[model samples]
Target: MLPNGDIVRQVLLGEKGVCETVSSDALVIDMSTIHPLQTDALIRELQEKGINMMDAPVGRTSVNAIDGTLLILAGGTDEQIARARPILMCMGNELVEAGGPGMGIRVKLINNYMSIALNALSSEAAVLCESLGLNLDVGAIKVMSGTAAGKGHFTTTWPGKVLKGDLSPAFMVDLALKDLRIAVDVARKTGAPLNMGIAAESYYAAASQDGKGRQDWSALLNQVRQQAGL
Candidate 1:
């Protein structure tokens, strides 16, 4: 985030003053991935000068860049996306219009959270498999590949939320906490030990307590990242 913030300062506010020459007709699309709040600040600054901006952060890696098949998660108005679409198409194969300014980064953070968390989960599972002396290739890989956690792509539609960068709740943290608490209670009564469900209850409860009661459940993924020290 520091490096990203430095990029803004150097490019937009530095003595070289690139933004100073921006025409009123210019649409300044910031393709760098940075904090949503920082994007808001940039938007405000550019607005005074009559030059609009879009927060269109690049997705995928350097290899994709070389082939011009990068995915750009853009946050701006429909008009903005339409205006920039042709230019974007030249550099990227996909132009995902996420939402207004800040939305792209929000989506990116949530997507990144899942990626980081899942990688950690997989690494830990791999260690367990190694310690237990299981057949790492077939036993572990094939088993996981067949499970819900691995193959539940269409069954679990997190992309609808994560890609939109919309954290507005279809299921609020408070409601999720209440439901999880009830689930834990039912498990206790039935003598069913829901180990993972119990852990999730703690996460939901903590998120609710943090004033994210009205936020999307994935917003709690930030807490997961923090707890994992990532």
Candidate 2:
């Protein structure tokens, strides 16, 4: 809902009572990874108009989205969720009802925060290893095949690109940094001490500042490589 920003509003306004009238017929399940604050307002407004709404933001990746193997975190009423299950089942392998309106977004933010943070740390470590004269090379064949340690987005598809110095956008570094920034804001509000989150955000910040913002999150490794002169 919020992640799409004004886009959702445009849809609702465009359809002429679609947002208002559709509630009288079908359920509205929001899958955007928008701000938690915006989600709450949208849910409340739609619910008041007799709409059956659920915030079910997705996890996993583009590959998962295509494979229907995503992990779904949902927030809405039990009855509404029961109405949503049939739709959700087609899109995800695992679906957990997080809580009410905002929980789905909250969980999504934290999940992204952790993922982006880890990628930053992992890239830093890989670079650190290279700097220490650790044969970080891993042989051209292995690099061509990609490394298992890259994990998640880095899997077979991405690390090879990183190793070969191609920083295309599977998931934009700017977007990852945005999520991390939001997570840091959430942590501050909740009084959570997230030292790694802070550090991860900083690394991404520096990477983005260096003009790799539109590249893949894996581009963080470039910073490591530059520092190691590898």
Candidate 3:
């Protein structure tokens, strides 16, 4: 079962439910974008039940999911994951075996930190370009989609969505905050400082509290606008 972990609390529920419902011998692959601690807890619960659990969180867009071109990071026993590789292959073009159990989620946490950081950078760039009357949508598009530094999906879509005030949830603000929280936890675990992550999480938390939790992450621009009294 594909237990999506884009939201912390919901992702936890999904993981737990799947762990409880499935047979002990069943292979449970959790692809949620949630915290590593949550994933670790779920994995432990599954292991106690004799269920094979792997943190196989997905990356890339929904279109990628539909097209079977997602990038998957998998964590589990080398032997267990070897058996599960075919299933992952069906859903993704790249299935990276990221060492033992929980490592997949750990890696995804770091990946999300980078994504949130880049998204913040992208929003600032878009705002700057707009302020400068440069209309650099096309250029930003090229830069964000083309540059290694701008590889995240938010750069591919969020700017225009923000400009048009279309905050519908392809991915929502709450989910983004959940991922940010996950990144914060990872930072704490590694003893790494994350000033930018804290700022971004605060922004997302504000957006969520503003009743835009279910709205698309692009709505963060509106939050910024509202704060600027625009």
lDDT of 1 at 162: 38
| CA lDDT, every model vs. true structure | 0.74, 0.75, 0.75
Compose the digit string of candidate 2's lDDT tens values, residues 90-173: 999999999976798899999999789776665554544454455665632246235434545445645567767787887788
Candidate 1, residues 1-230: lDDT per residue as tens digits? 13495688578867766687767798878777677788888888888777788877877878988899988888888888889889888788998879986677777767777677677666655555565567778656889887645764334435656346777887777887887787567656655555666677888887777787898766777666666887
Inter-residue clash pairs, candidate 1: none
TM-score of 2: 0.57
Off by over 4 Å in 3: 1-24, 137-230
Candidate 3, 177: how far from true, in Å? 29
Q: Estimate each model's TM-score.
A: 0.67, 0.57, 0.54
Q: In model 2, which residue pairs have backbone atoms overlapping below 3 Å?
A: 2-34, 3-34
Better of 1 and 3 by lDDT: 3
RMSD of 2: 15.7
